[model samples]
Target: MSSTPAPAPAPAPAPVPAPAIADRPPPTFRQKAGFFAMIFGMFMAILDVQIVASSLADIQAGLSASIEEISWVQTSYLIAEVVMIPLSGTLARILSTRVLFSLAALGFTVMSFACSLATSLEAMILARSLQGFFAGAMIPSIFSTAYTMFPRRSMGKVSVVIGLVATMGPTIGPTLGGFITQALGWHWLFNINIIPGLIVAATVWSCIDIDQPEPAYLRGLDVSGLVALATALGTLNYVLEEGPRNDWFEDQTIFRLAVLSAASGCVFFWRAFTYRQPIVDLRAFSDRNFALGCFFSFVVGIGLFGSVYMTPLFLAQVRDYNALDIGIIMMVTGAFQFSVAPLVGTLSGRMDLRLMLAFGFSLFCFALYLNSFLTAESSYWEFFVPQAVRGVSLMFCFVPVNRLALGTLAPDKLKNGAGLYNLMRNLGGALGLAVINTLLVERGAHHLSYLSENLTLSRPEVQAYIDRLAERLGDSLAGGVAGDPELAAMKLLFQLAQREALVMSFNDCLLLIGLTFGAALIVMPLVKKPRD
Candidate 1:
């Protein structure tokens, strides 16, 4: 009676056709230019971190700084970068990409010029720290911009490109630094950055652009978080920078700084989580893949950076290799690493990333253990074996962990992942260097004592060896002469002392690397499969 009219036949349900797969748009020419320019800038920034390796002695001599104080040159830059990493995302949102990158390049160039002119240790440290701030902002920005330029599927190839670009830092840094320091002086180390920085800054300004951040996410800068972070990192660096000279915890000042660092570190992490607007999205931890990848990445960081820092020290100082010679040795491993990047990059997607990582870690542990056996008379080939194996391991490391970290993450989470990755890597490097440096000092002293006791002149073997050396010299048995046996025995004794010292110091460095890699290897099986 209501005359429903059968509800108009309930309009036939609309056909539910299958969803369409959208074709990705091609990259614009401007994008190509910006992407490569950013790659170049990133190369230069990373290069700066290690370029000073060969020039450390010259810089120390030029500035009248001691071995202990000279490390500030490295520490200052590390400290600034550490502080800026968490802030990279926040700053990226606040400023347009083009403006931010250009400003960073400009500031970095200016700071390099300042470094060239620095006449005092303090001045150089300040300049290096300022340069670090700019470099810090640019690294994540470059990675973010480049990765987002293409669709997700294209990330593998892009990662290979980035790994190659990044490899230039360690590969060329020592070689170029050697040539610059030898041909010119240490000052040229800073001066060379000026032209490259300007070229990249102009190129980036013309090519890159990004729209403003969403207003809702644009919270005020977290100054409290900054203060807490700075205090912790800065305090910790103070302890590391001074520990070798101050005798570690025995020094009251270093003790205080260490205490302050631990306390401030805890507080900063707490406030960062509880704040209205956190500096970094610590919630990135909610993703299991990201978190686990980061854990392994950190151990890898300690192995990579610590070895880089310590090996050069031993080569330059202990082995008496000029920077050029050091460059030649390092080239062995660098070449090995460069050749393997593409393979690892491609294979990571197809194979189980965890298996790949575990294999790499195993090789790393084996290499460090081999390196621990180095003596003062060790050949280049002897060291090269372990180093070259590590070089192969590094390829697996540089690409796989990064891809795995981002595997299950959404697009929006990438920037946060990169930032956290950087910060943790730097921290690992700092801890690695700190522990190795401390142990080298302590262990070297202990080994010397043990060797002296075991190899006493009163021992029959040592006395016989001394007599044989004296007899070979064919000089008066009782008196000293230019080539006399008494003088010859003394010389042989001195050589043995030097050998013991070198072996003990290098042993300590290897111990650090071995333990770190071994621990990571043991924990590898715990990383869960892709649940997403």
Candidate 2:
């Protein structure tokens, strides 16, 4: 240091600074509030779609809608949803996600109020169409915004939240709708939405924040693609919604829709490949995982929605269980899902997701198989056990399988992937409902015919029944207790037999779901491993 101070000890080289980790913005108290509020909107919207499901009789009477017109209440909403799902991303880009979410909530609320006040079937239909348009925005926007708000590390947690909301809709919808319809009337189903929806809308508007709007150097709208997609979706939906009632292609309009639907679907896929920006990004399917994800989502949607639809119908109509009983049974299943979903999400990183999903499907299939044996005599306890078990299976499949589905996908593909996943779910559900309803009708007719023929009044046993009826009526074979106990007994017998036949039909249909589930087991091996 004395030798010219050793050049000041060679001055310590400037210490290199530690690299800074990108601090993820904290999930603000407001964002958190908004997230749950939007969830409330989602639950309300879903409940609206289904709650009225149990109150169709009352809705028709109140609005004076014919059965065909009554169907539009559900069909219009479903069609509007399908049409808007693919458009959600484009619309999001066009409008602020937060504003869109708020407007969606607002639109839904206003429409609900309007639908409540609708004086005629025509008015109700129009209100519902607008309601459909509004509601179509809620889910896709929520899903899109969720990806933006939550980091990758927190997705599992988010999934749990979304899953709970998803499961609860079916659980509480019919129960709430039934209580309100019984206590108040069908208009209350729509009216009840007003307060909750407005509250949700206000909360979301206050809390959800999006960046300032960018200039709209908008992408082309892909008009042809939109038309084709709409055609395919609309036609297919019509067929699905109407097929069971119209008896498939036997109806002229249905036949036309079937052809148009097929043609449009084929053309849409063909056009998609040729277009720069397709309505649906067909290239999403290029990712092996995403494509399979779509498949799984669709099939699972069928399982999920079909089971939800069938179980309640069987309980209320076939088994003669009340709305509360059906809700309780659904709650049992939903509770199981709530409990198990997080565990699956937690274990996903350690486990092979394909295996988990396979196991889930296997469990669901087993549950359905158990359910397949349902009869008019089956109790809710018998039903609840299997559904609860199915809940565990759905938990395994829904979250972990989703983890694998998107694990390999890039961020860029998320919007399309999510929307497609949702759309496929609804489509699968529509298909499942149509198939099951048709099967229910056909099976009922076939089985009823077979049973009725075998157990017909033509037998001596039936003659004895007639003789007994004549004695019970306190008029005898002298005039046969209505001058023809044979005809009266046969009429009474047919009525009784038809009810029994319908009961059998519904049970047989439930069993058929089990058969479909068994087929899913074979497809399990087709699943791929998550990317390392």
Candidate 3:
């Protein structure tokens, strides 16, 4: 009778809990060194993107490149880098982080040295393209490694380090370039990376062992998808970079490239969804947070690179400040960014991330609004407050943006997600620069025409202003020039009008960017709170 009694069902198996933050082992010393080395390598890569920007004139003169051609130095790097960024995820899975990053660092180093030695514009462009392609791998690798290597509790500190470098590299780029060009020469801009690049390559190769190479993925390599992706991004970057300069669709080359980019992009997306193992894993976007996070990244890029592009340009054009002077003024943003990072790191841990994002974006918007008030006479002190605000706000924006975007992704998805995330920021910057350039040209002309229409010789104030200018120039005029005082005064008046119009255009651009951040704040509530 006892044997006939039904056996009690076994208790349901206890749920297997995830490893706790404390339970997870801390990063080994080698991992720490390797991560930092990758960070530095990323800094060098991103830094190079803008390093030659302030010193482009010097590079132009050194290489005897025409103004139109000189632009390609930067453009080539951007195009090549954009193509490489998304593809890096697939490359990493095949080659592993150790081989991919070390090779990239080494290749980047070699290309940098080649760039330093380039005597012709063609050679320089080739070297820079290779350099940028190599550099692109380093950026996403740092991001992927950060999420995968560390415990959730440590993300705050990791975010600060990565965010500071991601931002500071570009923020301080013009400053460092100006200083280097003034002190040594333009060649040293590339030369400075040699020792550091070698060290990064050596250190990463020796220390990094995060993921083993998935050789199986190589068997299913999406070559067609890779080509399609490259073509789409490459052509798209070209169109954005050259569209404003060439009158958008008015230019035959831009129009053709735009069509090609659209076609290729369609194919790339098609392959992405249909392929067994696509070059990029598009499934990451299925996560609501990741999708929104990318849009935020794109908008943040507009503010970050857009501000960096505009400020120095304003200082140079309106104030007649030299490269060194502009660099000094720009230093305020970098200084505040560096100083506030630790505070942000601490606050990130204690506060709600979504709230932190709102605060950061709000302050950034405020800073941009301040910048929208800039006049032609505005100088260092005028820029100081806005730059400081922007610097602090950026720390807030970047930290939260990084966490919110990549935090919820599974460890397996982090690599691809990071690539897509970074790609949006870069694309945003490219698009922002194009729009800013177009606005400057159109808006500047509009303001100039309006001013010209208002100021006529018939107006008493205009006559009086011309009279004073003529009188001032009378003493400086000699011989035939003396009879043309009125003409000289007219020329000077035109110059003044042009300067004021350009400043107004800059103000308009700043206002638009500020409004963009405000818009971003409205969407913050949609991001799901990330799991710890």
Candidate 3's TM-score: 0.95
Global lDDT scores for all candidate models: 0.74, 0.73, 0.90
* Cα lDDT for residue 80, candidate 3: 96
Error of 2 at 325 (Å): 4.4
Judging by TM-score, tell me the better candidate of 2 and 3.
Answer: 3
What is candidate 2's lDDT per residue for 1-532, written digit by digit as tens? Answer: 1233333322132111111112234468899899889888877766676777777878888877787778787788788777777766556555656777788889999999998898888888788878877887787666655655665566667766776676567656777788788889888888878888888989988998743322231444467878888889888988998999987888999999999999999988887888655667767677787777777777777888788888888788766777777777777787788788768767665677788777877788888877776666777677777878888877776775565565555544555666676787678889988998998888888987987887755788877886676556543534333666556666666766777777777767666766676676676676677643
Writing each residue's lDDT as its tens digit, candidate 3 over 46-76 gives: 9999999999999999999999999999999
Error of 3 at 383 (Å): 0.5
Among all candidates shown, the one with the greatest TM-score: 3
Off by over 4 Å in 3: 1-23, 475-482
Candidate RMSDs in order? 8.6, 10.1, 7.2
- For residue 451, model 2's alpha carbon misses the true position, in angstroms, by 1.1
What is the number of residue pairs that collide in model 1? Answer: 0
Considering only N, C-alpha and C atoms within 3 Å, which residue pairs clash in candidate 3?
none
| TM-score of every prediction relative to native | 0.88, 0.87, 0.95
Q: Regarding lDDT, does 1 or 3 come out ahead?
A: 3
For candidate 1, what is the lDDT?
0.74
Ranking by lDDT: 3, 1, 2
Residue-level lDDT of model 1, residues 250-353, one tens digit each, is 99999988999999888789877887566677878888877887887678778877777767777766777777777777777788887887787677657777
